[model samples]
Target: MKTYLPQIERRILVRPNQTFGILNYDMDNAYPQRMLELVAQSPTAKDCWNKRAKFIAGNGFEEQTLGKQVINSKGLTMAKLLKAIATDKALFSGFGIHVNYNANFKISSVNYVKFEDIRMGDTDSPETAGKFALYSDWGRKTWKNIMRNKITFLDSYNPDEQIIKEQVITAGGWKNYKGQLYYFNPEVDDYPLIEADSVWEDFETEAGIKIFNNREVTTGFLPSTMLFMQSRREEADNSTDIGSGINTPSQLEKDLGTFQGAKSAQKIIVIEYEDESAKPEFQPYAIQNNDKLFESTERSVEARIIKGFSVPKELINAEKASGLSNGSEKKEAIREFNDNTSPDRMELAEVLEELFSHYCSNINPTNNWKIIPVPANVADDVIGVKAGAAINQLLQSSVPTESKIATLMYAYGFKQAEAEAMCTP
Candidate 1:
């Protein structure tokens, strides 16, 4: 048996406006860069902000930790603290990783730092320039930097405070820190530390707009309208006019109060009019259509948010697809699981892999382990139905053996070459 590695063109520069023009084709001409700049300038989406924050904060870090229990330098457990950091990262656009070490110079604990607390300096300087700097205060107003993986405090520290209080300088990266402090940000090219834009930003804006519409529909500020009274009397009509129509503001108020009281008590009231000829009518206000539209729009927005998170709509109690039979609904659920839920779980798995790897390297140097997410299982009935249909099609169709073999191979998750080999007579 021989092992073969696929030949890949690893250095294919897909980005526009490369410095080496010889290797670059000016097709789009920096359009990608302009688009990125636009995205960076876009405002944070407030409508979906809380929902996204809660999702990331609560569920993102839940049940994701591996190996030994992680406790931060401040004695706070990573399981709880990571949720806060994740929430902040989703709300803001970035976060910081602080490395802590024990007395033996080995890693003890790692913690998360808020985006606002840490600052980067001399980002343009190369790795060899020795001028790159990272600063953080952690809210105690004592700023410090990491030197050679060890936290080094600045000279401006109060000597009295340092002596009186055991000043612990916890920086972004410790002197012995070897693993990466940043994750999920590959766009920070040529810079020591640059925060990447949040992935949920666009969705947030859309969701916010929908929410605003829903709020307006639900709590609309409708203006009060006056009921007009038409008189048939001539210019000399000074006769005491007591009619069914409300003649004054006081009378209108009294009538309204009486009506409200009766309605609240679930009672019926009959008013005797002095003048039977005078008519009382109301200016019509219809809200049934508007209410229905708002409800539909809100449902659509909720569906979009669920789709954006790549979760099953059923999980959120969203309306199921209309006009689908029971069997079709089951099939759709399986498809949703395979397409969205499984992929999202897999991405989280990769993040956990990196996280565990970083922790293991520091705490137990020899412990090299990785965690894999369990894939969502599709229902056996759905699988069997689809497989039976495919087999029936293959038997009845006039397609060649190679085509049938290729189709069967695809259904069974075999490679193209392997399928062709199996089909060869």
Candidate 2:
């Protein structure tokens, strides 16, 4: 006996390309493109991805440039760069920034490069790789005939002062020299997996279930019934061999096709036979109790996808917040998510600060770099009182120090350390 099962397709399959001198992101060298397409198809997954990106970016940088508001000739600002990199990092677990240098070997400008447009240079080992390849059509159908002028080779980001000066001197001028690339990857050598990779299959499953439900509804939940009809006698001129069985489609079959969709719902199907003993038999397949079919599976898949993203459900779905008695569910969710993503924000800010301090003179490093955290946006319960007003009132009250600390920690969105310090005697 032959058995069949549903086939599932996965996108991430890293390999090296000797011809192009770059590491293929996947089998087709388009893992990022594939992941972008997949996420676009799933509503829940896309929402979670957007949320992650927003939380990662938070507010703009804490310190501003001394003289220049824009970092590059293209007018890219620090805030815009942060938003673009945060979006890429949230989706691909990696991002790229193109760094340019002037003829005097001084850093000139920087721009954001799409993660999908970059590939690691192929080498004996990732550590030894010193180049990166950028091509926009890596996954497009026209990739095979991609124009040579469209591809660019860039040097990997090297903070070593000696190495950079040596390379600049050897190249003679910045015009002929390949620009530098600052590629950030959470993983060291291997390509980083997407944020919610473990639940990617669930993305497909959820989409499939939704499509199935829509189709069933379109057909008005019609039964899967089969019709059996005896052979009808043909005229002398139309008579053919019975054993041939190569009969053309009957009128009944033609009618059935027209009866299959929402437009044909509630219409009656009639069958007529010439011989009394040749009546047709209509047999309905086992009628499934499909009212609840895949309902639990859909919920399970949705939960798994959200869990993979590490975002609380209340944050994703505002409707769920209506059930909370204290109205603090969303506030708590925002605080929790911000805390969870603090490391990502810190990593990005530190890298930018380091790069600016080493190369760019306009940015002030001593001012301290910080990416503002996502606000809890919780309103005060007392309508007339403002944010700090309630805290002042609580402090002046006769409440115990521990009670005041607890109120600050829970009622307001303050960390334990911060609340403790604020309430200290």
Top model number, lDDT: 2
- lDDT for 51 in candidate 1 is 36
Per-residue CA lDDT of model 2 for 281-377, tens digit only, reads 8899897676576888878888998998888887777553322222466777888899999998999888787667655555664556788887876
Please provide TM-scores, in order, for all candidate models, with all chains considered together: 0.39, 0.73
Q: Rate the local accuracy (lDDT) of all candidates.
A: 0.41, 0.77
Cα deviation at 101, candidate 2, in Å, is 1.0
Residue 403 in candidate 2 has what lDDT? 93
Q: In candidate 1, what are the lDDT values of residues 1-425, reduced to their tens digit? A: 99999997432233322222111111332222332333334322232343344434433332444333555546666455545554444433444554433433333456665444333322233321211123333222343432333322121112232321232332333443332233222235221111222233444444555565555544333323455444544312434357844343444445545554222444454544447566545575554555576567555655555554444454344223221122455455545544433333344345544454534254434443222222224223454566557666665688898777767566555566755665565
Residue 81's lDDT within candidate 1 is 51
